[model samples]
Target: MMTVVRLMALALLLACGLAQPASAQVQAQAPAQAQLRNPATLAVEGPVLPGETVEVAIAFAPREGWHGYWFNPGDAGKGMELRWDLPPGWRAGEPRYPVPETLFAFGFMNHVYKSPYAVLVPLTVPADAAEGPTLIGVRAEYLACSDSLCVRETAELIGNVVVGADGRRDPRFARWEAKIPPRIDATARVEREGETLRIAIPLPQTQALGRPHVFIAEDGLVQYGEQQAFYRGEDRLVAVLAAKGDANPSSLSGVLRFGNSGRGIAFTAERGPVGLGSTTPLEASNAPSIGWLFLAAFVGGIVLNILPCVFPILSLKALHLARAGESESAARRDALAYTGGVMIAVLGLGVLLLALRAGGEQVGWAFQLQQPGIVLALLVLVTAITANLAGVFELPTLAGRRQASGSFATGLLAAFIATPCTGPFMAAALGAALILPTQYALGLFAALGLGFALPFLLLGFVPALRSRLPRPGGWMAHFRRWMALPMGVTALAVLWLAVRIGGWPFAAIGLAIALVVIAMLMGAGRRQRGGRPVGGGMIAGGLAVVLALAVVAPRWIDEVEADAGVLDPADFSEATLAQAKATGRPVFLWFTADWCLTCKVNEKVAIEREATRDAFADAGVIAIRGDWTRSNPAITRYLESKGVAGIPLYVWIDRDGEEQVLPQVLGPDSLIDLAGASPKTPARGTPQ
Candidate 1:
């Protein structure tokens, strides 16, 4: 909510416009007795020449725990006002303020200078003015505020400047000028869309940015307290800001604060198209190189083989590995074929992801699982695999060539299912892929595929490892049948995911389609056993499945309620996050999806437990749950902001706004320990 003070300030600006000087506004609210809590003094820097401009500095030294405002006081507070009294034909320019720190108090944002600071105003002398000492003075009025209190202060400051005398320049003027932000050489462009303002500023790609912030000088142009999102392209920086009310202006002027370094660049933006360019986050300048990202992706892929989501697919691969022990050449061939399959699948998905994002889609890793159609397809495929494992059907083996094809198909399935479960190093690699260049990003994806296939590839090439495997025997059949159990479980999980993403009706139709496909497969198996042709049944079954999907696609709608757990967390949103942090309570924010097995595992082990719940209750923790079961732009943006591509992301923001990102794998005591940690005193305007 916009505060009344800010609203009134904006209304006054709209009514009076820029033509009405700040001094008049100050005089309207001036107190009879001046408050000098934050004392001000005036100084002239120079031996001013007749027609030249010399800077006049209004220096302020605020008392402890008190601060003065900038030219634009942000959401609330009064900007300093100056009523200049100079000789005829003399002129004064607008006051130039140094970059100010942000203060967040009671849901309002204030731009203030806490320590000693100066505002430089250029005073231009007339060409006809006498070359002699002249008196210059200003009645400065401003607001001084501590954390809980504010006072309107006024001061009458005077300075003398000798026009013709050779007076030495004040050394202090150099320091004051350094504090002021210099104007950028390139022009910036801004565009307004509804309540959002997007500004594109040209900057070198090599420029290092740390938590960049934009301070718009135009009153009512933007909601000062709203979170600003920054992104970087090849040679441009884009800033997204929320506009305040219905205010629309032809041009905008502001200062771009480069993190907390007290350095900024002043920019004026005119109405124009602002291209978002790449989805790269501004922090990517500090990100690791492509080689490191590739290595991380590879390692992450190896770890995925151990997660529960890949177990169903790994079962088939295990059998393939055992068969590889037969002959070295055969084993190598199978390995290469399987590796090719995995690479093709992983890279294909990566290409699709990149293309969709380029086409302006808000999506992330495991994005296919969000679609009901894709989920249904997966369910049907897993069901067929389960039936084959259970001996209800058998896929005909075509000697060496068939073996290779089977390995390749298995690789494709493994990569598709395994990608959803981000393990260890995979998150960072995948997150960087979203912002990296096309060629480099594709390399990372290829690295992930190669890594995933490395273990199997090794088995095919290394005879020593192959010899260690148990010899193919009569027990192999029994093992395959037992493997059906996990595959069956995988099918059930996919069905559940379908229900979670779509409604019960959609899930029911999908289940019927899967059953129809399974029945057709079983019929074909029976025919094969009876030594008859079975191709017609499979073709008919495929047609039936396609027809059913076509009929139900349009009617699909998401109606499933969010999963309930012991924690009883609130649904996450940007507004909710802000409100939670504003309360000065510890926040436990976790992102999950029905399709993510790791997310569920963490919930069962660490989150949805009586101990964790009690700890949170005792600590007064605010739990926020972000469900990514469907395509949510907000959740996607939040994940990108945290430098991750997918979730099972657990972020703990303490009362003081310090954030600690918990690991993907959570222990039973992880949340318990977090809740028990000592609280720190909340700091004003701390970044969350």
Candidate 2:
């Protein structure tokens, strides 16, 4: 027992004190030898003959769980770079990289070599080179990364080659040479649209291609992260790639690979049309049926009534409905005229939009609002309405004696106001309509007009609804005065839009014109109240002058604003979105326009709030906003891709690349909750 106790005490002493030196020796010995061995090996693949070319390779066999990069590293990483030290009259060409496999890391896709790969470099031996052995040296720089960590590596390489000898090529080098892409004589055409480049390569019609991918050779010309879409044509293969960095390139050279075949053809691009005209060639199988499109258009028009832009006009019309106590036949006649007005306005605008699109102009819903003149015209019209509603002047009654003409004009105004506020259901139908056959497209627009007129049409035919309305009385006068408030607000909103579209000079001039028109309206109202005969003619002349001035003022102000050359901060684009996405974090996208009331309201109440900003910061969310105040093809194409008809588009892309689309009308809490940092209770941004 005493002997065992003495042994235990000796073991404890060794464990506590004497083990430190032994452990240190083991760790020190193990690290020195491992660190000295390089992970890569450099070799000369062929004997360097006098005045002959030879090949050299820098081969890497990575450690377990680590990998190196290809020529175009993709997303994030550094490709191998070599600085060659050659003798006099010796030259080194660009390195030839083997085809790399796709590896994903940290929410990014990387082109990497996971196991073993070799990069070959060509050397030119001068005619005057000596016959003895020559020393070739290189310094290589590269990056290696595992799933969790990344490390940069630098290697110094040296190799000896016998000059003036019969060169024997390495069989291993032959294997890598076979993997190099062969240059093809195929015709390549490239078309540029916004930041996207579309390349069309003429492939033999008889050949069948399965899942082809294009690997671009030039750096800073294409975004490596966005998916490249390939479309097979009868005799051509087309690829759509996102462009980055430089806009102008002499040629785009890339390798086109078929799935897993280790075979590809490389070609340089030339600028020309691919015979596609203006329409994008999408797969026909994914298109919705015509019936579904019509239904979507109808439903979208119905939803428009609830939009902020249209709802206020509806409120104004509701007050007018209370005074409809005329004979049933007369009331029905006025309703039909109003319905005709709304239908004509919608159909006419649709025709104009289609005409412009057919003429190769890129336009979409509420495209007229992009015109400063049209905005200013609408402002004048709305201002006149506000004055009339405020009892500045009584509009002359139509031949029917109940302002049937006024009802028709109101319908026209309502249709105009409703154009800017596109809802969810409208997006798909309208997007398809823009690209569908002409007759079918027109039919969709007509259906939308019918839907817009539905509510008023029902009131016209249904006598019961009219009977239920309150009788006209002294209360209407008070209501008309109150109604002017919203109308006045609408006028101010238009003036604000003018400022946004043009500048402060435009707004100041517009406000001055509005005040002048108001004075004329009051004068006419006084003259009519005094029983004067010529008051109506003066008011008519004044309205005409107001319209003329509003149209002409924009040209003058545009020159000045153009000279000032101010930049708007909110015009986020696809390139900006791409940059934000490259961060491997969440992104919040918002599309808005100067004329969209709901967009403005959402911007103020939800997007621009301090809480929302804080939530976004906490969640590492990047906020990007797109401005659609003008005709922007890039923005239009982006909207089409997402099936959005107009502004107030909210898109949330998470870290894992899943997308969530938020509602057009949003509250601060909706975005705040969505931007929360909890992964377990991740906020869903999809529209309800």
Candidate 3:
């Protein structure tokens, strides 16, 4: 008896004490990425022969009104730079850039690259060339600028070759040369629409350069702020774009910037689609690949259905429903019946998919992945329910118990969650599914869902499977208790994603509410059986959860999405912010990462303060601010999203927003005027 008592005490100590370490570990699940997503594409290549220089460049594919500077950035924008990851013997060189065009913005005129451009690097090899093959790799970093702000980034590009007695073209070098982005065809037509521009280029296959950029010189033609290029059919590449300023179709003179087998170059464009009047060897085309796409997506669905984060909750939900199953005498019979439900639901989805494909409908890999609001809502709901199960809060059982509950709920959740986990089989399945006939698509989906569910279903139908499970006894209790830990972990995760969208306040409120419910339940548990402590635990639990959810539900429903600000654009005018910069005074804009959302949204809406009309007014501010948005590439490198995982991105080009950042939110008057306070010398001729 003493021994058993001692063991129980030991187990309790471990669970409670180690919970912190476990929770901390769970929180750290976020990836430690090396770089933020930036605009420039990195390039690296080198010839092994002595005296041969392998040239490389950082290419910028800008949307419009955007340009980036050479190694030496002129005026306010950042300079393009390159880094190398090569072997010991291989030597790297700096960017050998083409002379830049003069860019005029605000009151400043600086030389930079406009449209898509590349920098050349001349690599030098020694007279004694290496006998074997050598490899060279590089990262290209550059800033792409638009009228509003700049996006800086480093990308990976690679090239390698063998060296011999004399400098000669090697087959490997030839291979890379082929991969070089092909130039834009000379014969293409540019068309302009409201906030959108389309360039029709004739092509048979979609080339990487189909979205190649172009500029329009005519008044009222071609928008700058929005530009997107895609292949609309099998015969042409259409560049869709947003029109800026005046956009008149006729009398529009456009210039198309594209790359040929040789390098980046431009061609003068006339208004209208490319008439049959001209034809080039190059044509951009992308026919729908119905068969392959469906196959890939189906495969992806299969893989994702079993992800760790998803699987546990699915099993438990089904288990709850399974209790309601009428048959209990034979466990095997119960398991088989549950298995039937899973197969039926999964195969049914496959049939539905086939029906859609028959209608010539287009489906993307997890086409449903784009709905952010829906994703967030589901995540919150699932995690919250799981939290309740873990004893974080209590709730009345919504799902009836039955053998089918575990299997049925698992099947349903698996199907839904599979959308985001496409991998491996994803490519082929999705490709085929989208293009194949309805019958074909459904067949592919069937294979995928069936493949995914087979393992779990097999385990269910086979009672011997119990042998694989830990023995159900005192250890089972320990396992159930430990299981609660994962529930807490899952709840924390859902809350984390929520924080990114809803901010820290929402998360804190959620945790706090759950806490209260737990407390109340504890209090209720002390009641006698007649009135009941059994359900008392549940009452306290439910209250804690409801209180937190009370805040969360309303916030979500209200959808109060505004830029969380240090500048509080509502507090100041764009013209006002710009005027501060024009006085040669550096207007410091501190884009806080989290009081609300990532710094990106407010960063763009706020930083691009001086629209064309206010250009001269806001020239002095450097727009130097920290980015705290989720997956914000620029800020990620600097560990800039320093506060909460999300919220109230503060602006401080003028003032640090230190006081505003305090209490973790922003308000007006929090703005500190720079000219009157800081004694630092002001910048010259800076744009407002």
Candidate 4:
């Protein structure tokens, strides 16, 4: 009776199992949530040729509010894990992904794609395969998430590709391929600083990378989703990333993301010091070393002593040295003081320049002369000097005084005027100074001042040089008078510069101030000659009024129209140069300042001449001039790019868009010859 009952129970259980529907059982076995989301689809890009490789893409189109993870998913998601099913003699390469966007949800950061995207895998066919269709399949495991919910999904994707003699490309493949970050020929250095890693890469200093971010590919090296700090050092791009615990990878590999372009480059980290390689125009990889730069600065200063703008001043100083011949001890003392003054002046100017740069001011050589007020002040001083030289006043104390202060003042004046000329070798040294360490830059300036004062310093020590100078006599008076002519010319040049920089009205006011100051000086001379206190008081009051005017004039003067016929070349801008180069035409670019006499001479001789202009027009040359008359940061940066510290920077770009740096001092035929010569594409770094 028990055997019969047990058999009945087993038969009833079997009947109940048979009654259930097969589709319902299958649906119950697989989670209903997994079936709700669509699976990814796989497709071959095009026909695959035997022995040739073609792209096989696994594409996913997420539903609204859902997203897919990138190769290196951040914080809280899983990337696509592919299990490939391939034919016997076939291979599949690693997946290539497009740049990813950041997604934040529930206190977790994710690198994901919210829209449809494809991951590309290279599929290779067997060399001897027959012309037939082959099935490629992949089992993809990924995590898909919306803002509120997340799900782990599995998709079985398959595609068919035809093996043919020649392969055809798919349009979809091109789109995905374009999105993948390009591999860059770059090296990086990872510097571990406590809890942060400074990853430095060699990128162009000129690139405007706005708030750049880094996406590390290596696991556990960096804390993803943490804020990245970016900085630029010379030519290196650096990112400060929060480190994950004590994890330090032998090499860091990553992608650098700029904004909205969805463009980036993959870089493999090089194990070494975090070097901000050659961040300056002067410190370019191929530029001269520090020692050579110092030598260049010294040599440049020596050359400045002979430039036309400086020649007259040297003559006056030399004459002063001759007057000192009466007492060797006094001469030596004066020379020391003058050298001290020169060094002090140069270093002081250097300090000001560095300070301004630190404060983010766009300043360069002779920057002080850019201001109308300073120009007017210098004009007055020079005019007064000329009058004294011409015997309008007996201010022989300037050079003939036994006091060291007079020599000191002369040294300061020499340095002041010397700023307007960039001698041979100066452009490189000074440009380097701007980018070098602060101390190194100051050292260069000191060397330059030492060179400028060398001649006078030598005369004090070497009695033979001093003996060579003619003894002081009445003829010295006549020589001094003749020097007044050059001094007056210098004053007139300042006046002209005032007009160029501040316009005609400013120049007119400067002229009126000069006349008034000259009259006051004349009155003081008369007072001394006639022994009259009344004349002295008149002179004092006149000077006060002149000072007041000087302080007030620049603020009130109307900047009027500039004089024409001086070759008003188109103002040079980066855009202008780029546009000119894009036209496939040659370009002539020159940087000039109102105060740079060498620049003026070059313009009048080479650029402004009729022959040069005609040649430029005929050759379709774009003539562009950068006026450094004011504090133009753009021009300053451009000058630095060419390793130039001062003006008269002439750059010639041939039709091939190669830059040729022309000589600083150009002759009448220089531009004409340059323009007439047919453009030749230069090899890398051929001297301009």
Candidate 5:
């Protein structure tokens, strides 16, 4: 009865981007000149020698709430336009700006100077001429914005510079030069791998980086808001950024900020191999330590045992325990074998995941399920196991014999199936593992396996726990038969998942193959019951049919369309997300996959409810859903930006540009409360 209760619980548990054009030219005459609260003043650092250059600084002192744009104002705002009125013999160079801070507003990332800042332009003096004072003038037009409003402001300023030598030099030029990022001596290299852009800048490994960030000067080269991944080699720092648009340029210029030390270096990178073979991941300053990550992985593995997705596998383990408990040595042997099997499977998966990422594949945890071939294989295996548990034909050794190998195989199957569910604490560890060094990541995987096997291991080693189990007897046979129910449900679930991942025709072929194998197995069982030979011909025929069907199934496979949900969310892409957020409405973005059990549970419990739909309607929330059942590079990049390795991620961006990441496990009222808190506002026009 207890087995049936556990089985019942197990049954319940089982159940494109587009390129954006370059920034448009902002017409200076679009808006009337407003009050110059954030005003610009011009000055010259003078006593300029003939044939030499003198620096002219255009300084702006913005009000407390006002800010001015940088030379390359990120997503919105206009860069300063300066028309120079210089002496006939003099020439002005391109303007250089200091590293600017980032501002995210109305779904746009703006590069601006919040406080006092300066733009320096060098003035070249002619060799032939003037020794007296020369008049220099510039008409500076720029956009200044506050949190809620923006204004176009223009200033015309004039300054004097002595060409010969009696004029005093401005002392502030030294400070202003310090603000500009100095050009690095060594050239950098950048490579675009699919949707990712990797830039390698030559910097000594000894140099400390606080919170490094790369700001590309070229418009539409990379996504301005995506978080970057940094790595440090012996003499170079490599930054991985998400690429935007379809523009492929030969060379790129960017500024690399060395943390919060107010120091940065400007570099130009050519298109080439970034050759940073082996490097250490440089995490953010506030990231947790390795020990904490290990603990989290271990705890997460323990928690997975209770999750509904793993309950079917647990039933198998329970039956193994019942048989092994009769003998102490047998119990210990089986426990060790099981542990070994689990460790091998988990570590193997970890290595494969890392290897794929290293090879430039954008994939995450349980990536195998994303492939139709793998899902088909899993369906076949589960169906066979279900039949075996239901008193059908036995395999040569695994099903009929009680051997360590059988226990090991069970452990392998358990771990393989349990990974689709990411319990609490697992997300952080796995996310970090992706960026951590290979060895450390493997250690975390090992820790997870040990934790998963710990409970079963203890039962074998500790006689008191073993004694609590019911003695091995006739009940064991009935117990095994009943276990078939959950296994059958599990098989059915896999069949449904196959349909979702592949198309109906593909699933139908797979189902027919499973039935053929079951019929052959039943025949073998009847022959054995009659004390006649279970012919090898029947087994070979079944194997041939299964192999032939598996080979042909891919032909019928079609792209599975996303199921319509209650919220009726638009399909998620980077372009679509930007468009939705541009409307200045609250955005509710969630990512889920068909095979993810936890995501299904969440949809049923929290997301797909009428309350959530009504609340979002009231709040004017734009719903964007990312379906990741298949491999999607855009979705993978977004997940990496959020520092997560798996799905069921919820992001809420309010109308005011405030972003909040809700918990992975959602409550019944989580969406309702979130929507209710942010009242609806009139839709704002998209940023120009």
Candidate 6:
């Protein structure tokens, strides 16, 4: 009986009511410094001058018993790395690294740092350097070592190199910046062979190793994190090149993050085989260790609460708790109930997935969103909840007593809407859950569920936290009444997304049903107590409309695939692109997912508009889209090749294959302009 009650509560909450907002848990745990056996800090200081080649240093701060690494260690060593983000119109000169020394550990000659050593980086300010505050962000993603274990960390360090009005040196820079010597005679070469693109950097001297320390850093060229690099000889540092998918060497080009003395050391790494642009064949999964997989899932789950649907519901919950101002025990009970509700939903999904898999359903991890029916159903649910949240309906039958029914309902509704906002990390985590051994997969999902439920649970268990509340008053009534606007706006937004997916007609139908449902709910509210006649016909109509919608929604959902009018090489057939170039127009390609809120927002207000379409038609532009609703290896490769770590990725391709990947957040005008940039030349070809 309790289970049934819980189920009904969940259904009502998910389908209509606004979510309760719990406090957002910001998990920013400090990475342990004790784990910093060989701590290194790189600082950029100079007698700041315009166009002066100068020195910046990377200093090691190793613990008494632990040590760090040099550029090249004799054997079994990981080099210290520094990555630099420099502003435009500026260049950096490579550092002259201090030679590494070898120490014996466990009967093996391990090259490492026994004390602090300084490796210098030379900065070269361009002759055409624009005068401004030069702020550089440095991240040290280094492998720190101890006798027993190695730790890899990425930490941020910042420095300001001010270019002066008179081109005079900043007194602060004189302390540590070093100038790169002129006429250095070494160059690094990158090449492609069957399974790899190999890079060889000539070392001025011999160093011991099975592999050399190699990093890829090129603007519009080179792959990172995926390439396999090895050292050949003391003077020869070899790295294998792997092209991002469909991104050909006839393709290779994009910003690459490579290793530097401080992390961004400039080595003229070679441009390997132009013919070796596609690197999809070599994407071998080194499958993350089980422990690593669990951690990733947990963290990913924790981040889910920040999604649009989740947060609003959480906000409502916060308001409810504030209203209750109850004891810690009460709060804890509420937390447990809420968390249990969320977990049951997740577990239900898991069981459904497992059952489908058992039944030989060809469903993947994205089975839910991939099905248009599911997406449409979810979209309708969102609309209903949003309307309810806007306070268009009054179902408060326990009118005399203040009940949190609505707040709890909102939280349930939020989970349904939020399911689609899954990020790459979520995909990766869920992928592991689906692919690993049954026990392992279940545990991974369990961890994720626990993580997602943690914040609300925290609210229940902490009384002091609960005591912090706003008393119910006139202000409370006003706030509740006004808060409905955002919910109304959100409903409109979801409706727009539906239109983009299925076209104007589907959007109209879905909307018609929502209006009918709302009108019935409102009419019923306005009716006298215990009187069913007023909204009776409306409710009957709404139910029938809903049943019809359930059948048609999936079909409509399958129709909408939206993108940022950016052009990607992978989306274009080279033959087709050649035609587009002949016309002298650019192309826009947008990659999207159903779960992506930002994508839906962009599609409605920008991409799906007739005005925008007509504008593109006149501009000789080309638009292509890749949807991530279901797994597509082709799309994955295209993204990786472009060096995008994540999506709603928008790429703009000029007539010359000059590409610009836009930001995650898209503006309508910017998207329209991106489409307009690619106009057909005199050889004018029709867009694909």
Name the best candidate (by TM-score): 5
Residues 220-287 of candidate 4 have per-residue lDDT tens digits of 67777687776666546677789888876678787876454454556678656664353332223333
**How much lDDT does each candidate structure score?**
0.78, 0.68, 0.43, 0.71, 0.77, 0.51
Q: Per-residue alpha-carbon lDDT of model 2 for 542-615, expressed as tens digits?
A: 77877677766876565212111111223466556666656666777778787887786787788877777777
Question: Which of the two candidates, 2 or 6, achieves a greater lDDT against the reference?
Answer: 2
After the best TM-score superposition of candidate 2, give how far the Cα of residue 31 lies from its true spot, in angstroms. 73
Question: Residue 496 CA error for candidate 1 (Å)?
Answer: 1.2
Ranking by TM-score: 5, 1, 4, 2, 6, 3
**For every model shown, what is its TM-score relative to the native structure?**
0.60, 0.56, 0.34, 0.59, 0.61, 0.45
Off by over 4 Å in 5: 1-286, 312-314, 396-401, 685-688
Residue-wise C-alpha lDDT for candidate 6, range 157-205, written one tens digit per residue: 5676666554454333322222111111123445555556655443321
lDDT of 2 at 357: 59
lDDT of 4 at 39: 45
Candidate 1: stretches off by over 4 Å: 1-287, 397-402, 535-538, 680-688
When sorted by lDDT, best at the front, the candidate numbers are 1, 5, 4, 2, 6, 3
lDDT of 3: 0.43
RMSD of each: 22.2, 24.6, 30.8, 21.2, 24.0, 26.4
C-alpha lDDT of candidate 4 relative to the true structure: 0.71
Give a tens-digit lDDT track for model 3, residues 1-688.
1123224433443454522244433332222213322244444443345656555545555555666664434334445555677655556664445434555555433446665555656566665666656666666555444554444444566555555543454333223332222232224566655556656654322112322444443323433323345544433545565664566464343333332212222224457743222333233333334444444445544564443324435434344323322333433443454445545654565455444322322222232322334435455556555544454434444222233444455455545544333334443453344334456556666666665655555455554654455433344334334555655565565556455545666555555555554455445434532465466446655755664566464354222244534333322233444454544454554434322221233344534333411331333334444433232323321111121111233333332211112212222222323323544544545332
Maximum-lDDT candidate: 1
lDDT of 5 by residue, 246-309 (tens): 6566899988875554446687888888754787778632234678789988988888887665
Error of 4 at 338 (Å): 2.6
